[model samples]
Target: MILYTPLANTDIFPADNAVFTKRHCVSYQNKQFFVEETDKGDFQVLQLLSTDPQDFLRQEFNPGTIIKEH
Candidate 1:
């Protein structure tokens, strides 16, 4: 499984350094990804937890779950 965080903007802002307090879990083709909206109201991928399709089918995989990098 590959984890990826998509960049919303190339230009860095001071606020970008701030931790994301609110985030949403999204699934595409059974892959789960974490996304949060920036101050600019643009959606950005905070983290990508799993790329495995079967992982998304698990009961533990739900929305509003906090994902962190190890």
Candidate 2:
């Protein structure tokens, strides 16, 4: 089946409530990041919410990169 709506996929088919529980908004390096808790107790970068373009260029903030707590 094809979906033609301009709305986002999540908006069309809402995600599981448990999925949101794993996600968190964290501040790292003075930047806000949307991260998800991993099985290893590390946070994985989901989305980078920053106004600076340079933040996007940083590999550390890239999606899928795991952020381990020191």
For every model shown, what is its TM-score relative to the native structure? 0.32, 0.79
Those runs of model 2 whose alpha carbons end farther than 4 Å from true positions after fitting are 1-5, 8-15
Instruction: Tell me the tens digit of each residue's lDDT in model 2 across 1-70.
Output: 9978889998677777788889999988888999999988999999999889988999989999999876
What would the per-residue lDDT of candidate 1 be over residues 34-53, giving only the tens digit for each residue?
Answer: 77755555445555578576
Question: Each candidate: RMSD to true structure?
Answer: 11.1, 3.6
How does candidate 2 score on lDDT? 0.90
Question: What TM-score quantifies how close candidate 2 is to the native fold?
Answer: 0.79
What clash count does candidate 2 reach?
0
Give per-candidate clash totals. Answer: 0, 0
